[model samples]
Target chain A: MVRVDGKGSGALVEIRSLDKKYRRGGEEIDVLRGLNLDVDAGEFIAFMGPSGSGKTTLLNLIGGLDTPTSGAVRIGGDEISRLSGRKLAAWRSRHIGFIFQMYNLIPVLTAFQNVQLPLLLTNLSKAERRKHVEAALDLVGLSDRMRHYPRQLSGGQEQRVAIARAIVADPTILLCDEPTGDLDRAAGDEILDIISRLSKEYKKTIFLVTHDPIAAKRAGTLLHLDKGTLLECTADGLFACKPEDAGK
Target chain B: MAIPLEYNVRSVFIRWPSTLVAVLGIAGTVAVFVVMLAMAQGFQAMLIGGGSRDNAIVLRGGADSEMMSAITLDQVRVIADAPGVARSASGDPLVSAEVVVVGAFPLLATGSDANVQIRGLSPIVLEVRPNARIVEGRFFQPGLTELVVGRNVSGTYAGFKLGSTVEFGGGRWTVVGVFDAGGSSYDSEVWCDAVVLNQVFKRPENIFQSATARLASPESFQAFKDAATSDPRLTVDVFRETAFYAEQSRMVSTIIRVLGFIVAIVMGVGAVFAALNTMYSAVASRSAEIATLKALGFSPASVVASFVAESTVIALAGGAVGVLASLPFNGFTTGTMNWSSFSYLAFAFRVTPEIVASGLVFSLLMGIVGGLPPALRAARLPIIVALREL
Candidate 1:
């Protein structure tokens, strides 16, 4: 019932009192509790937290991969949390791009084919789809390695392919869950540089979940989560109590 | 929207060992199914192929087969004289009064004794049965202890070649010729003169087992049937030769088909379980991949379709292998006891195109049935749970 007007209003993601709960046997464990946040267009935000602090859960809720227990997630003026299962999947395909810690490239598909997967859901012609896939792989600097399978690519190259797949559809928001978690320091830095360039040059809104402090430092805004709550950390310390509290 | 079919195909090849288990299991089932149906088909073809639409058989009333029918010489004459009977070049009716009896003979391949039909034929038998022709040597001379063996009989039994002597019924009968009946049931028989067989088997002087006559035309069958059944003095059953042989094949073919189907179904049960186990493991091992696809916004329907497509591909592969494995059995000769004639009948295995198609369709159905539960399980898995698996 409460909708946030995000499209043409310069806001890309808007969350309000979002809560996620999981029941293990009999006890209800709160994963995300009463979370409120607003991300503007073309901004990059990093989510940092200890284990079990609901960082990935909040990203999943925003991407429509998982629904919030009792809150609304609005992106580009669409209330995704209220959408049904099939509609939510379609919405996610059109609006969100996902990058996982493990690269998550389909092992059987070559880099080009994996990047072309999300586009298969569209009604694009084969040639048109190929054109888009090649452009995305070119952007990721893997144009020459398009035919190489995931097992044949290096860790950093595989991650680059994953990033190409994540952005091939040109989704409005890019959700990266520990994108640099599995890479070495040099490979991880290369990935961060690409993410930073995507946000600044391509005008893409990005939300990244990570444990690496260096990866978090590249984001324009950094937020820390503890015990299902969100806190903003500035250069001095974690000073902002909450986005709602700071607004009050 | 559906996923590209190539994705499922490549996945099947990527997991070759597990796919091989499902394929070979289904292959075993389809092979058993096809080979058994082929046996039944061969048996049916042997009997049905022996008959012609323009010929009619005469047997005693209430008799189920020629072996059970007894025709007196007077009755044979009356039937042969019927208005619709066709005549040969000599103007005599194209009729044969034949005696049928079973004789035990040793198989050349196994040396085990089996019952073979000994037929006593009148002179006009080749005229009545146009398909029966001597392929080697000559027909037996009348009034002598001479016999001609069918090609299948000579091939299957010991000591039945031309110039060889077979001891039976207290005498040695010399084989004078070999006959072929174009793959008909008569190819399993040994032929001799009616008078000689009567004397050898100690049958009555004026009695024979059955009589067959060629009709003037196939349309004359109704007139022939009416003439024979209306005679109060003669108690006889008349049938078109085709209908008679088809009746003879009913019980044996049914038994064979039922046996074949039972074996296939038993093996099919094992195949279904093997497929189930293979698919469940595939789902388990690929949970993370499935989760990734789900995260990429693929619907559960697409996931289910992909897995089902993979399963069907495996089953069709097995079906193809099964068809190839059963190919060697086609036209391979073997023998079984004909319950109607109370004798061993040799036939070849027939693997018709229809049988092959049915076997493949059967395997495809098995794949669909076997893949359903696992596909549903894959679809119903919570995305969060699957993502956490890895």
Candidate 2:
């Protein structure tokens, strides 16, 4: 197990004593409690947990989609958890790119248009935006499929399009929740290899949530979340955990 | 940032069934609204167009219309001598004493009996109403049972065609001519010699229903009215013919307006509900799509604007169709009873530009009302929850 000996002062993402509570029918459920973590830039972290283990919730909090009930989440020196909805949305556009398991590419738009979505928020001219979208599609190996719609592509191709959309704006971080959950083994491996290249070459800080231990092994840092706290894992990650204690 | 317009447009085309339902509902409502308003406009135009600003009608005091007034020949002569009366080329005051009576005639289209205005006009009538010109044959001669059918009523009533004989006023009056009255209400009347009509109807030849006189100018109507009413020998009310006809049109116009509004409101409510149902369904079906847009950093206001624009486009399409559907009724002539004169008045439907504009504005308003709530719902939906939706 790799453990830090000091506070991460120059870390890209800093979480301190974070708590998240959800009220359901007058009952307050603590989804996350007193979570502390520091992630450096260009680190590829994989979070493996069973359902209701708060992995997605923790990712949401870091992406500024949800506010923590207590404590602070600082990204690039800004307290994102304290931002309002509009400010957070602006921040997300500038810094965070999300890829969902369902590959939520707008069904009505072609692959090129879908990748161009986030760039619309920028002051980029039409030609500049087209250049960036083309480069992103090229990176994801979807340059030839730019004119096809989501329904026209297979699950792997749709997820590749979603990836192109995420990186077209050159965001500071990528938050992918089950990016390959719907794909078969070969498709999933291809997606993971592309994601690894983004981290190594583009230096984009990526946080991936997964249920597969093989997927977790591809990350530079592997951590397991249970109940409301994260546990460190060895270099082999899930292989080091007891079978029931790993993904469960 | 706003979502691209193509997203909303393609969504509309992709789900054309619901969009079509909304479009047709708005179209039907606008069609009914435009046609109803056209009816009122046509009726009012025909009546108000009958009068000239440079002329005055002298009626017995307290009579609102010519049919309700009875003035003696001596009173008509006194009115002719009024200070502001215009003189003709022969230096005679331009005054015409006319008698009006309602005759029962069968409608050509329905064969049902209807009360038609029969006006017994003196020789000076054509000069006083210069807009009335013989279009088919010459005017009737004095002391003869000859009639001139108006252009609007020429073939609308049985036996009113040119050269046809119809019995009225205890005589067989021959239809000798057809006159065009510049699309005025006078185009709905039959004209004959006053003396001949008085004799056949057994009324005194010295008595006439009203007298029309040309004023020196439009500005001289008040002076003429003052002169006529101030004469002690004549008990008459003088009105600028334009003002009198305007007042005569008020009752029917108001009825038509009220009826049109009532029908439009009822149908408008249904159209709005249909729009609401269609938009709500669109929002429900597009929950995931909307969530993805929001997650992509599109502002809530932009989402709202996009959806509202889609709804407006649908409504405007419907409005255009409605306008086109109502155009064919323009100038389609029909007749209805004039409550003031108790005579059948013929007019055509007038689908004016103003009514078309109003119909479009009305549909636009419906689109906004129907779209706002569902758009807000779509905007306020929690992104994560909606993302999970099917």
Report per-candidate TM-score of chain A alone: 0.91, 0.92
Question: Candidate 1, residues A39-136: lDDT per residue as tens digits?
Answer: 87888877878899999999999888888999778888899999987888889889889998899888998999999999988889999999999999
Give per-residue CA lDDT, model 2, range B318-371, as digits (tens): 788888888998998888899988999999989999999999998999899888
Query: How big an interface RMSD has model 1?
Result: 1.2
DockQ for candidate 2, please give it.
Answer: 0.55
TM-score of chain B of each: 0.94, 0.94
In order, candidate lDDTs are 0.88, 0.87
Residue pairs in steric clash, candidate 2? none
User: Which candidate number maximizes TM-score?
Assistant: 1
Candidate 2 chain B superposition, TM-score: 0.94
- TM-score, chain A only, candidate 1, equals 0.91
lDDT of 2 at B221: 87
Q: In model 1, which residue pairs have backbone atoms overlapping below 3 Å?
A: none
